[model samples]
Structures are given as C-alpha cells and as structure tokens.
Target chain A: EIARAAAALLRKVKGPVGPLAGRKVLITAGPTHEPIDPVRYIANRSSGKQGYAIAAAAAAAGAEVTLVSGPVSLADPDGVTVVRVESAREMLTAVEAALPADVAIMAAAVADWRMAEDAAQKIKKDGSGKPPTLQFAENPDILATLGHHAALRPRLLVGFAAETQNVLDNAASKLTRKNADWIVANDVSPATGIMGGDRNTVHLVSRDGVEDWPDLAKGEVATRLVERIAFALGARDA
Target chain B: EIARAAAALLRKVKGPVGPLAGRKVLITAGPTHEPIDPVRYIANRSSGKQGYAIAAAAAAAGAEVTLVSGPVSLADPDGVTVVRVESAREMLTAVEAALPADVAIMAAAVADWRMAEDAAQKIKKDGSGKPPTLQFAENPDILATLGHHAALRPRLLVGFAAETQNVLDNAASKLTRKNADWIVANDVSPATGIMGGDRNTVHLVSRDGVEDWPDLAKGEVATRLVERIAFALGARDA
Candidate 1:
C-alpha cells in the first residue's frame, strides 16, 4: 500500500515535470565479445543491468533514449530503443549511428584487445605438442574517440575508470587523456561479486572535484543519476 | 587449459612484483540495513563488490587484507579476514576494530538515515486512515569519521561519490568535507551499471586532479587498480 501510494505520488509529480522531454540520450551496455573462432570468443560477465536501468531512468525523465547494447538476455526497458551488437566494432558502428545525442554514456565493458584475426574454424585439441598462440591487437578506445570528436560529441561525455590503487591519480590522468567531462571509478575484484552481482558502490570524479556517496542499490543510483542529469540540464537552461 | 596457462604465467611474473606486500589494508563493503522492524528496514543495494574486490586485489598483491563487510552473502576471499555487520553502527564498529591499517577503502553504501526506534512488531496495516509517520535520524558518516580520525588513521582514505550533475564539483566538496585522500566518482544512473552488475566504469578524483579510464570488465578494473595500489605503496615506501 505504501509502495503503491509512493508510486502514485511519483506519477503525479512527474506529470508536470518534463525535465528531459526532448533530450536524446545514448547509452552502451554489456560486454562486447571478441571472437577467436566461429564458436569460441572472449567475453566478460556483464549483465547489462546498469545500462538497462539507466535507459529506463532516462526515458522516465522524458529523454529519447537509445540503448546500444552488447549481447545480453535482459528484456528491453520501456520507452528505450535498444540496438543490439556483438563485437566492439559493431558497438562502435551502432553508437555512431545514434549520433547527436545530448548525453553519451559509455557503459559497455568493451574488450581492450581482440584476436588479430578470427579463426575460420574452431581448432581441435588432439593433445597438441604446443598450444596455439592467439595474436591480439588493441581495440578502439570508444570513450576517448567519442570524447575527442570534433562533431557529434554530446555536451557531456562521461567515462568509467575501474582502478585498484591510486584510484584518484589514475582517474585524473584518464580525464585528461580522454578529454571527458566526468569519470566514475570503482574497484572490481572477484571476491566482491561486482561483475555479476546486483548492487554497486562507486565514486564520481570531474574537473570540479570528487563526491563520495553512501553505498546504495543500482536502482537508487539510477534514479539519483537521472535526477542529477535533469538538474544539470535545468541549471544550464536557467 | 588457456586459463591455467595464463594463471601460471601470471604467477611467474607476479613473484618479482612486490608493490603492496607488508601493507595492512582495510576495506568496507555492502549496505548497512537499518531495521525499523524485524522484517522491515531501510537498505540500499550495495553488494560490496568494489570493496571486496579491493580486498582481494590487495591480498593478491601480498598485502594483509581485512575486509569489514556489511550484510552480504559473499564468502571471504582467500587469505582475507572478513568481519560482517548488519547496520551502519555495526559497520562503523567493524571498521574501527580493524583500524591502524596502511590503507582504508570505504565502499559500503550505508543508509544516511535510520528509524529512531525499531518497531518490535511489524506495523499492522489496519488500513489506518493515514499512514503512520516514521521518524528518522541521521546515521554516522563512516567515511568522514575514519578520514578525520585523530589516531590510527590509515595512510590512504578513499571514499566514493555517486552523483548525477556537477559531479566533479560535488566530489571536490566531499574531498574537503570528508578529508578523504581520494574519491571515486560515477553517475550511477541506471545506464552506467555501476551498481549490481558484473561490469563497472568509474572516475578517480583527488587533490592532484582527475583521471578517467575506458570502459572495461570489473575484473580488468580490479587488476589495474591492484597494479596502481602496488605502485603507489611502493613509491611511498621508497
């Protein structure tokens, strides 16, 4: 009953609030697979929950949201136009297609390196004397590319810095290298279940400074993020 | 087979890399659930992934890791000592207990408010003509408390800021307010997925400046973070 009332109140409040009604938001989610063979590929565990949640929040805030997602099984969020892609290259293409958005959030766990050349067929292991050496090459830095773009660059270009030590120092360096307006940093060791779990704790960094928040649910984070975006755009207009 | 080989190579290369060894590292994770009733409480979705990952990485780097976790189901990482708590108060107690460490990472998403009094029994929904007003009181600022501790303060005190707009500005304010050595910042909007997902993107902020990183797997972030921590500690030692 309380939840229902709160939801009703929210609807009432949102009816008159079009903070981002005409804004276009582009988001990337999940892990891009770097294929080594027809059947096998290198991929990380990224559930796309964060990206999906952001899409929902952006739409709720009245933004026209385009979600460029990697291969994930999650359902498409309401009011969000989702574009699915397989590899980093495909994701980049999709992002390019969704250009001129007001905000571009690069949330996908893009593989930094991919197999130099994908194998036509899967190699069979017959107790080979030596293992095959799979050559790799660095993939495009999507955030940096978009951030440094002369055109089609969103007003706000945000990147993620997942660091373990000197977290601040490394994030600061990245801010300049990527030329991003903002960066979010967190530590993601295996024991924390950050990669596959349902909750997160993070920090926000930018030119102005840093702010630390109490750990909260992803949903809460999404809602708060939307609120902030709305406030930021509104302040700009004012 | 490929994974095993990579692990072997990593082990061989890691032996000569002493970065955080002989360091006493402390970390906090998850959300503190402040109970209003036995079955009801205010809690956030802080799975403690970032903090746990930090602990694991520190341990992997040969540091003595003490993890003070909130209510979470995650098992303790290998070679890590885990201290579990249920509420902000408990979390504070646990953190204090593991103090005088070389570094302290505050990653728990702790609730900022708690019911003044926990109801012994669930509030009956007698369809009371009006909902009962529950009084809330402020919870302790764990980050600030530790960051400003007069004695046994860690050499490095890291805090997280989950913000939406004016991210850098707000983070900067927090750096001063909390007296934190560093702050990790993120939008935490549903789109970014820093919360309960397997992947994350973030920014690092501090007195020196900001650094941003490209989107990568949470594990990759952890590995990179560990490397930074090792380097920073080594530099300090030297």
Candidate 2:
C-alpha cells in the first residue's frame, strides 16, 4: 500500500505539464478611459480580447498569469488572476504590482493623449456658439517603460504598432525606439473590421526580420502565440 | 477661341487615366458555404470585414467600391457596391465578371474544403440512428489563383493566415509555399475576439523583414493602409 501510494504521488508529479510551468507572465488589455468629466471620458473600442487570450494561453501553458485589464465587460479567464483598472495611471499601478514576470505582453490599446485636466462635472453647452477648446497632454508609453527597464524587466517584452503608411519603416523605428523584443504590426483601417471583429490578419516584426501570416480566427492566433512564447522561453532557458 | 480649344485638348490628353481609375472596386467577402442538404454544409466564420473594408478603403482612396459579400449583413459601408453570394464557384464567377479593375484585392475568407458530393435532397434519418458520414474534397485557393496569374494577377498579392503556433515560422513557410509578396498573421484563439468584435491586433509579414505596430482603431488601420498603398505605388513609379 505504501509503495502504491508513493507511485501514485510520483505519477501526479511527473505528469505532462505546460511549457510555461513555473514561469510568470503578465499581460495588459483594453483601452484606458481618461475621465474628461465625472460622467464622460475618452476611450477607444478596445475589447481586451487579445490580452485576455494571451493570459489564458500563458496559464494553459502552465505559467502563473496576471492580467491587468481596463474597464471591459469580459469575465476573467479561468486560471488567470485579473486586476481591473479604469485610467492609465491605475493601469500602470496594477502592472507594477504584477511585476517580475517571465514575459510581459502589452496588448492594450492605450490612449496616447488624454485630457489635460479632467473636469469634476459635465460642462453644459453654453450659448456661446464656439466649440470648447480642450487642452490635451501625452500619456506615458507603457510598453516602452516596461520594455526598456534596466532591472526587474521580463525576459521578453512585446509591443504592438498600428500603422497606415510606411508601415514597415514606422514599425522598425518604433521597435528600436521602444526596445521591444517583438512588434506585431497591422493595418486596422476601418475597412478591415479588425477593431472589433472576430478575425484578424497581422505581421510579426522582430530584430531578425519580418514575417507575414494569413488572416485567421482570433482563437487560433492565441493558441499559436502561446506555443511560440513557450518555445522562445525554452530557447532562452537553454 | 482656336488657342483655347487646343489648350483644352492638350489638358484632356495629359490627364491621368487607367482601367481602374475612378472605377469602384467591388469585392466578395469571407468564406463560402457549399451545402450538402438543408442542415449540412461546410462553413467557417470568416466575418466579411477584411475584404469589405478593403473595398471601402479603396473607394475612400478615390476608387468607386462594390462588395459582393456572402451571408454577412454588416451595414453597407458608405459609398460601396455590395453583392452577396453563397458558393466558391459563384464567388469565382462574380470576381471574373468584376474584373478589368485598376487593382483588385482578394482578401476573402475562402474555404479550402468542400463536400465531395452535395446531395440534391436531404438524407432521411436512418432507423439505426447512425449519423451520416461526410466526404470532403479540397476547395480552390482563390487568392493564389487570382493573385498568381501569369498575365492577370493583381498588381499586389496579399494573403492572410490564422496560425495557432510558431506563427512567424509557419508564416515564413507559407510565404514561399503560396508565392505571395505579403501575408497577414493573426493569433485567433477564442480569447482574441478578432472574429466578431470591434478591435483587432495583427502582424504584417513580408520578404524584407518584420515590423510590429501598436493597436489602433480599424478605421485608422484602413486609412493608413490606403496611404501606404498610395505611397508604395508612387515610389514604384518614381
């Protein structure tokens, strides 16, 4: 009986595990809503699908996953611990809290510009026919910050670039400027229906070279991305 | 009066003109369905957005656009021609009839598999309750055929891939296999929400190398793509 118990325990321990076993992965998703007023704010159509999928994929690959998501309606994926935030500052704080991950994927559609000063209350449309002149400011580049961290940075830091013209040239510039390991570039023109669609087509840009892929369902992309992450991690460990 | 008439003639002769010039581009969107019976057929949720958007973007960029789509009922983008179809064979014919374009982009989600023999009538349920077996055959690769013509291929050949793992590695393989100039790759696990949602993240792969981009609105992506295409064409001419 004792021997049988020991064998069962060993089997449990030796079972096939995911590639990300013992690894930690951090992901950020959705668009931060910068409050312009108590009832209104600036936001985009980021649904947090890609980020959530990455977190789920990492977890399935046997990693400890932390998902820092913006104000999205999606439920937390199974096997992932989710931290929710509304503003860019809050998202940064949440990301900092989920530190020391093996990989950090910044898939969030962060707003580059925000209101200079959020109004405490909604401003009424005055009889003055002129439109209101609102001041704006630049938001921190989260991907750059995380990617260029001298210490406590993840082994792999990935960023995204959404471009229209000079796609490759601009993406290359961003990759070098941001110090990211990889950058996924795509043409999200309103005509592509990628902003909130179930299918997507993208390009992968790395220091080595550029690789293009066929259009695919989103689910398939996540599974593939997780597998690649695993292989990349394995190579790094070796 | 004679001098003015001569000047007008010269201006008319010098004006830029091409087969695709000022003509609307109409595209068939997404994969097709070839039914075997009332309840059975082969289908994929391709979400007609990519091709449809291309049509719209092309139109927006100055070409008149028409979209002969499948069953998807997405709102007709402003200023486009839309025709709906149901089968690959139908799509092919539609495409042929719509040709003589200045530029045609084949971005539809074409099926690569179809029922070997579609039954004219529905098969009745058997007394044994055994499910009817399905036999499938390979469907045509529409993009390759249309984009690889010795004389009729589009000026630009673009293909899409929804890969689950080793995306770039596999994308590189497909680029050669398909004899295409560009491939768009997307990681499409269920979590990516790229198929039915409002936002997308993607990568652009090509021969030169990889270039990654940040996430942006789909409309922005389209506008940028049009701008890039224009720039590329201008550079080619120069």
Candidate 3:
C-alpha cells in the first residue's frame, strides 16, 4: 500500500497521469478582429475569460493543450502551447495547424463579416454630409469547417453559442448544423453582464438532452466541463 | 535660510505645486466604440497609453485634470478625475461637460462615423454568401466644437492626428481647420509600431511651424508636452 501511495504521488508530480494524460485538447478563444483599415477593425465583446479558464483547466488535467487565441489581454495559461492570431482567417489557419486532437473546443467569438475592400489609407471625410457606404464580405465559418473535416475532426467536438434570445434552441440548432457533439450556450444580453464577466450560466446541449447548469464562476464551470469531457472520452474508449 | 528651506519643502509636499499649479486642464483619451449590434462594434488601435500618460503628467504638475476617456484597460491616473465613456457621442458630451478649462487636449481616436441605425440584436449570417450593406452617419467633431466655442474656448487648445501617411501635412491642415493652438501628429503605420507601442516619435504642429520630437518613451513625451504647455501658458500671461 505504501508503494502504491508513493507511485500515485509520483504520478501527480510527473507529467501525464490524469485521465487526459497523452490526450490532445485544442481550443480557440477571444474575439476575432476583422480589419476595415490599417487603424480600425470590427470586434466583439468576448473577454476570453471562459475559454482561458477552460484551457488552464485542461492543462492542469495533464492534457497536451494547444490554444489558438485571438487578440486578448489574457496572459498565457500555464503548461499550454498558445498560438496567437488577430483575424478569423489567421485563427482558422492556426486552428487547422494544431488539429488532430482528441477534443476541439470552439470558444472564440469569430466575426462573421470583414471589409471586402479594406482601405489602404484612412478613409477621410469628403466634406460632404454623406458618409461612405461600407461593403462587407462573409468570413469563413471555423466551427463548421472543423465539423465537416471527417478524417481529422476531433473525436469530441464542442462549440459555444452566445445568444441574446432563444438560447437553447439556437444552441441545439448549432450542434446539428455544425456537427458538433456538444454546444455550450449562454445568454449574453447586455443586462446579463456575461460577455466580460467572471461568472457564467451555461447550458450544455447534446443529442441526448439539454443540461441546464447553475450560475457558477467561470473557473468552476471549466473544471466541471473538463471532468465531464474526461468521462465522455472514457465512455468512448470503453 | 532655514525658514526658506522649510517653506520650499512645504511647497513640495503640499497639493498643487509646479508649473501648472492652479490650472485646469481637460483631456480626452482612448478609442471610441461605434456599435453595429449588441455583440460587435468598430474600434481603432488607440491604446490610450499616450493620453493616459499625459493625464498623469498633468496631475503631477499640479493641474486640476479632468480626463474624459473611452474604453481602456488602464487604471485611472493618480489625482486625475476620469470620466469613462464608450462611444464618440458620449465622449463629446462628457468633454463638453468638463469644459471652460485653461487648456484642452484632444488625444482620443474618436470614430468619424457610427452605424446609422444599430441593430438591437446580434446580426446573423444568412444562407447567401453576400453580406448586408452597412450605412454610417458622421459623429460630432468634439475638437472643432470646442474650438468654435468662443465663450468657453480654452486658452490653449491641442489636438492629435494619428496618420499613416501625410503626417505633417495632415497635422498642419488640422491645426488651422480645427482652430487648435497645436496638433501633435504621429505616423501610426504598422511598420512604425506606434499605434500600440510604448515609444513614439511625434511632430508638434502649430501656426509657427513643426517641431520634430525625438523618439522617446510615452511617459517622457507626456512630461515634455506638459512642460511646453506650462511655458506656453506663462508666455500668454506675460
């Protein structure tokens, strides 16, 4: 028994002992900036707190984590390999490069549109009262692309849906449309203060059913989610 | 001699000492966010570092500083009253409310335009590949409005022009058009690393001519600018 206890302590001390040992976890975080010019861009209100917490939790679980993050003020999580990018296209490239993982979590709030013809110089006022019309182009859907990548797609794919209305319905639809195994949905209404807040109340939507989670600190949510992921992967292996 | 030394020490320790003692200075900093929807907004690359440094310097120089700042990650400077705003219109209102100052420095990268009618909800991508056309409306010119305010126009009005090209020419034209006493211009090209970098090489433009400042840390620039403002105010008084 003493020998077994010593071995367990050694396992905890050394690398790759947890349930996620030897597994690869890939995650995307932050808001993608879609440039309109050299100086300006369009961005969302994602603070990247939840995703960063999840990354940290995964790394703590002894997973070989690769995080593809956009421009965020967050520091790199301990024991995680981070690849930083600015725009959605760059993020997609980075994510693709870090793929072939056991789990892929799409948590970044990717911009849907970008300037079709970004101005070379600052767009100046022509002294006319009228403002210039802006032309936008649709950005590549990163989650959908990963979901459709049959050969290299992660064994368990997760996506996030931040909606103001019909949160569960939107999340369920997203799960099917994106071919993701689970959708973490949250109401990001301005009144909710969830976009940049530390605490979140997320609902887990899967093919089986929806699990409404209580309001919890983002770190707690991450820990619970990571635990669930380990169980799911164990079941899959069994 | 002992009494004189004691008086000097007291002055140094007391409130409102230095060149700008008993002066009121109003400054604006950071980039304004123009909302397109609840989730996304257009923003510039202004880090608010330069402006925040200036506010700190002004406060250290014994000026009663009112800093009208936009959304920035920076903490409020010591002894400075900071009014936080998000959009250009809100910034204008805040600046106007903190008016009738001895000096005004417009350093914020205020958006020239905002959405004509921002959406109440997050915009979703349709099945079509095309993106929706966006309409913009011009924002109020805070600097120009203050310059044109004859009754409460500051004794020394300053503005900043962050340009990628035609830096000097744009600054010179802006000095005259905005009726500002000086224009602090800098090349914010990505190559220069000035937009969000610590070091800056700025040119001070005025009716007299341009003064090319050496590349200096942002804090040093702020100190020098505050000294110049004090000198200018003294000269005006003389």
Candidate 4:
C-alpha cells in the first residue's frame, strides 16, 4: 500500500540498495561525556565522523536510520533520525528507544568509567597538598547488552574495536566476547592520524576470518560497509 | 614608516580597535589530550569556542594574534596565526614559541595527569578478575609557568575558572595562585547550559574586585573583553 509505494520510490532513488530499501538501521557515534561536575567531564578523541558517515551511507541506501550520538560538533545527516545524548547512560537509553532495527552498528568510543556520583557543584581545588581522588563506576556495555539480549536484538550486530597493538587478536576476542557478528578493528595510534582524522584503515573480523580493509576515507569506509551489509542481507533472504 | 603604514591599513580594515592596534596578543584554547595508550586519552568538556572567539576578536581589533590550540573541531580564523597540538606539553611549547605578547589568555582545560609512561601497546583486560590499574604523572601547569616567567610574561595575563559553585571566590583564588592579573569565572552547572554550550555568564575578577557580567554568547563576551583590554592598555600607555 502506501508504505510499499514509498519503499519502491526509495528503491528507485537509491540503486545501490534496491534490496536495502525499507530496512531499519541503528547506529551510535561520538565520545560519551562522563560528567565530573556540571562544568568538567572526561571524554576521548571521538569526532563522530565514522558514525555520521555510516548513518549518512545507510540513509543514502534507502534505510530508515536512527543515530544515537553522544556530544559531538557534527551536523545531522539528511534522512536520519538523530538523538543527542551526553553520557553513557543516556546513550544506552537512547539506543534502547531506537531499537527493533534490522541492523545495529556500535561505533562510538564510549567511556569505560564515570564518576560514581557526579558532584552537584564543581569540585574546588584546595591549596592543599593533595588533589581530590575521583571514584569511578563501570559504564554499561552497550554492544554486549544488545548482542546478548533475547528480544529487540537486531538481525545483524556489529561492534568496533579501536585498538593499538595486537589489533587482530584483540578484535577476534571481542567478536566472541561481545557476541557481535562482526567487529570493525582499527589502530588509533597517534602516528596513524585516525583518532580524529578523516582517513581510516580497518579490518572486519567475523566468524569465518578477518577481511583486511584497505586504507580509505571514513566516508568511503561507510559506503563499502553498507554495500557489504546489503549483499549479506539479500543473500539471507534468497 | 612602512610598518606604520601597514598597521594603518590593517586598522582601517578592522575598525574596532581603540588601543589594540599594533599590539601582540597570545591565546591558548581547547582541551589538552593526556595519552593513556595509543588509542585512549583523558580530555575535558572544552569546545574551545570561547578561546577561539577571543582570538578572532583580538585579530579583528588589529592585533598580531597567535592562537595555540589543542585538538578541537574548529577552522582557523582569518588574520590569526594558529599553532595546533594534541597534548598539554605540546601546547605549552607552542605557546612559548608565540610569546612576548602584550596580552596572554589561558583558556585550555589541561589534564592534571597523563599516564606515567604510556604503554607501547593497548592495555588488555584479562577476563580474569580485575581491571588494570592506571598510573598517572602530573602535567606542567602552563598558566602558572607563563604567568611566573620573568622575560616571556605578557603585560596583561588572564585565566578562566569554570566553576559550579562559589564562582567568584574560586576565580579570585585562582587569580592569586596562578599569578594572573584577571580571572574570568563562570558557572557551568547543567542548569546554566554553559559547559560546551555557546552562551556564558562570566564574572571578571581583577585586583579592583569583581565585575559581574551578564549572560551572553561567547563571541559577544570576547568582543567586550577585548574592548576592556584596549581601554586598559590605552590608559597605561597614556
């Protein structure tokens, strides 16, 4: 009916994803802020380029994409629903709200620890000899949570492993541990210029083996990933 | 005569300066990344908007401006020289190289500690029993270092205090402790929407006591602050 006509229109518009039309894609991106005070928070080197690129790519392929993003200075991608969040907990909540998707990509650099209890007031430095000790609590493991969930789990679950050394082994281990179908691994060494830079060299680790992806722009990476995803989903249906 | 003519041309182009013309201004902006490993670093909730705004404003006032910035998603301002760095140490070096200015503003949220010695490889968590312990080394205090330097010290030094409570008191304390001439204090409580937000409510604390400033956009604050600086310098030179 109306939905099928709209899907057909989208399929006509996006030739690359004629099969991907009407599919729902969920993505998470950026660095989660762990509030220390109202003013200060702990964050990392996540510019949201990769996740934004993925969201854009999925949308271009005619997927209904919902992007749950942490605080980032990036423009929202066209045709994608964006939910802005501040912390790991909030990001998890947003992800849950955007669930029941066909595919899920967890690419955000989530902080492992946050202040157990955020100080309502900014912590003052006493001219005292010792600095204040910060106590941390473990953040929710978003990938593992969704992967292990009984219901509301996406058909295809993907995670990211931003590693420095032993990249392949670490990524392989994470693929099993997180129960993720695929783990996109990359080295974020300062020398690599991948942390906040546009270029990335990643490997896709799956149950079969690792596929070493060539160095490319983040946007190109997203495009290739989406094409692979479309092919796999089409094969599954066939 | 040639130098004076060039100065006159620049002043004609940027008409805001009453006394900032021909003056050298140095500014530091953004959050310093303290490396934990090749993949991770500690950072704060700093967008560098305020510091960048100050640099742009100073340049608009016909000042020879040098902005030393850490990792931030911002384009370099026209008519301002920008030195980019990743960590606090690098920022300090860049700031030192751009020194001997008429005015210096420290707006970088520098991490207090970095990994004592960064692991060459990413630290892996054993599924065993416990998380790996992290050791940290204190970072150099760039504000105090510059403020105390005999030869490289600027004529007018300013520091900022992003406080949640006792804003004026903390700012005053920081002014004396850091040897800065003025302290710009702000409440960054979540209620204020100031941290990583565009609008700011700041208090200018000087030897003459506190001047409560109204909430305004970061760019507006920069403009007014530059005006005040121009006035002060004009009076001193006169």
Backbone clashes under 3 angstroms, per model: 55, 77, 0, 0
Residue by residue across A1-238, what tens digits does model 1's lDDT show?
9986886587577642356787889999887877755434555556678778888888877788999999787899987999999889999889989999888888787766677788764433224333355566667778888988898888877776654356677677778888987776655444556656677677777898876656777777677777777777778778
Question: Model 1 off-target regions past 4 Å?
Answer: A1-238, B1-17
RMSD of 1: 24.1
Top of the candidates by DockQ: 3
Q: Please, what are the lDDT tens digits per residue for candidate 2 over residues A148-236?
A: 77887789888776654456776787789789888877665556776667776777889999988689876666777778788998899
lDDT tens digits by residue: candidate 3, B1-238: 9986886687678856879999999999999999999999999999999999999999989899999999989999999999999999999999989988999999999999999999998887766878988889999999999989979999999999999899999899888888999999999988999888899999999999999999999999999999999999999999
Q: Where does model 4 exceed 4 Å of error?
A: A1-17, B1-18
Candidate 3 A-chain TM-score: 0.94
lDDT of 4 by residue, B6-48 (tens): 8778667865354577899999888888776666566777889
Instruction: Give candidate 3 regions above 4 Å deviation.
Output: A1-15, B1-15
What C-alpha lDDT, on a 0 to 100 scale, does residue B95 get in candidate 2?
74
B148 Cα displacement, candidate 4 (Å)? 2.3
Per-candidate TM equals 0.48, 0.48, 0.95, 0.86
Estimate every model's Cα lDDT from 0 to 1: 0.74, 0.68, 0.93, 0.85
Q: Give chain A TM for each model in order.
A: 0.89, 0.91, 0.94, 0.92
The digit string of per-residue lDDT tens for model 3 on A1-238 reads 9987886688778856777888999999999998888899999999999999999999888899999999899999998999999999999999999989999999999998889888988887778878988889888889999999968989999999999888998899999999999999999989999999999999999999999999999999999999999999999999
lDDT of 2 by residue, B93-178 (tens): 77777765544555566655556787654343343434455565665666666666676665555566654456677666667766
**Residue by residue across B84-152, what tens digits does model 1's lDDT show?**
888898888888888888888887777666667877643432333333555656777899998889988
